[model samples]
Target: MITEKCVRDSFAEQAGYCKILGSSFMSDLLTGLGKQLDKSTETGRRVLQWSGDPAHKADALALRLAGALHALARSGQDQALAKFYHNPELSSDAEFIPAVLSAIAANDDELYQWLEFAPQTNEVARASIIYSGLSVIAKRFGLPLSLYEMGCSGGLNLQCAQFGYQFKGVEFGDNASILQLSPDWSGELPPDANVEILSRQGCDLNPLSVMDADDAAKLVAYLWPDQPLRIARVEAAIAIAKNDPPKLEKADAAAWVEDRFQADGAKGNVRVLYDTIAWNYFPDPVKDRIDQHMHEVGSAANADNPIAWLTFEFDEEDKGPFLKLRTWPGGGQAEILASADPHVNKIHWLQEN
Candidate 1:
């Protein structure tokens, strides 16, 4: 977990205005601004414009504007920022932050609705890395999976394999027909295997019902502020949901995992996995409980009835995502598969001893 001291240190590295505000001050200010911007009243604009420094004022205004767009996107308001985006004068002035807000605001739909604005606390890149790692493990385990994702905001990464992947000299998916491919990779790719996903289920603390168009827009806005691919992915997921919405449940991860594991049909040659980012959000006790349950179930697993865990998570010492692969019925320590950037689509296989 990133410590408060680390957070403070990060704030200390900021320049000029941000530096002056300090971490605590900035935290309060952001929270206050987020609340105030939702009102969309004169007071909001006045507060937004009150920063003393010119740069700070611009930053504050941008933040306020982004926050409002974020709220609109979260609430599923369709194209709420369209007018703002189309206004030629504000286009360049809005910068990347506003551009993201404007794009999301324009894409209000069921699939888009699942996207939620996560604070910086949410580690998207890490999550992507974990997904990539798990994909590799899935291949190695030679298991046909029925994936169940927790906190599956927008289900973008869920489509990782379906989407074209290109990294290093290797390539996967149908890429030549689509966009140019470029991803970072530094190890051997996972062994080729016929992998099939029988089903995909997801749970979230707050599931986006998409009953409200406004909520869909808000989801798009919550996506990373600058990744257009992410926007496209969310849009695609939305389309998928329109045809067949993912089976989603509003529930706690620990309880959900316990119940699922306890249920008779949950066992298969299926590989149960979670990756880099989501695990951190789980409280320690929840994590412990999940781990214990996995271990108990794993103890009974075998080659014919195999259960495996594939995780791509932070390697604090290496400052990158590390892949850990473990199997059950011969319960033991997990093997380190590889370590690399989590967002890179390609997987690098490490030699197992």
Candidate 2:
């Protein structure tokens, strides 16, 4: 049972993250709301009495509430709330607090319903790290790759190479691409190798497609209002994805991996399973099964058809996610390439590559 203390703690915890992620307004808003949320209202009752662990790594309860309110503000139904959100620095807590409370009371049903779904921020900026990892893999194996991603919200990162990147003075990808990113980069550059992806596929329990207007809106909405650059980057990436939409399927990741993907068949091409900031959402059972299947499949792998598991995800030891790579011959042992910001603004490469 999630205690009231735990629920409140989650809001405070998420507020801290908001500050770290460069959203002082959101941090302030969450802190204020946690102290003042009226438990008598439907939305407040639902949040205060939530059943599950409400932490960002768990149910992300705070983010859900934040997203819901942001959506309402964007919809233009509450002009006062919209003004506060758009110009947060100019609004005082006295005005902001009451507007939020009034908004919650009026749209309790909608906000409550919004909390049911997890936030899917298919961040495109993280591609800088991912493409860099692929460079290392390509340099090592010198083979074309077959890319598969699990928990791919809209499969935007599946089409990462389609977007452009400029890592610390190093240029990569198509220069003409609309959604270009130059994350604050560190460490030596990986030796250039052709990362020709023969095919790219992704699976998720609830895959959002770039073609869906509602899904695209939600994807953009999940970003903090203060960080308009992040929001604009995702929007541009979504536009890029629409031209050559990602090949995505709605399916269980473990089931898909065990039943469909095989490490042995694709001769002369390296099979790569990669995910960016999506591993935490997987249930423990699913994660275990996926690991087991990879190990089993890897056991039969060879030099001609190598299998690689690449990830930009949180490990037990780090504050942020690490770019990790594990190969077939070296099953169960992953090399930590670099550590990066969750939203992909900075990266410190641990390895020279």
Which candidate number has the best lDDT?
2
Candidate 2 — what's its lDDT?
0.85
What would the per-residue lDDT of candidate 1 be over residues 219-285, giving only the tens digit for each residue? 5654433345654555554554555455777888888777766423444557564544566667889
Q: Pairing residues by index, what is the TM-score of model 2?
A: 0.87
CA deviation > 4 Å runs, candidate 2: 1-10, 39-41, 91-93, 318-320, 329-333
Candidate 2: tens digits of C-alpha lDDT, residues 174-264: 6688888998988877567787888889999999888987787788778888888888888888888899887999998899888765755
Give TM-scores for every candidate, taking all chains together and pairing residue i with residue i.
0.64, 0.87
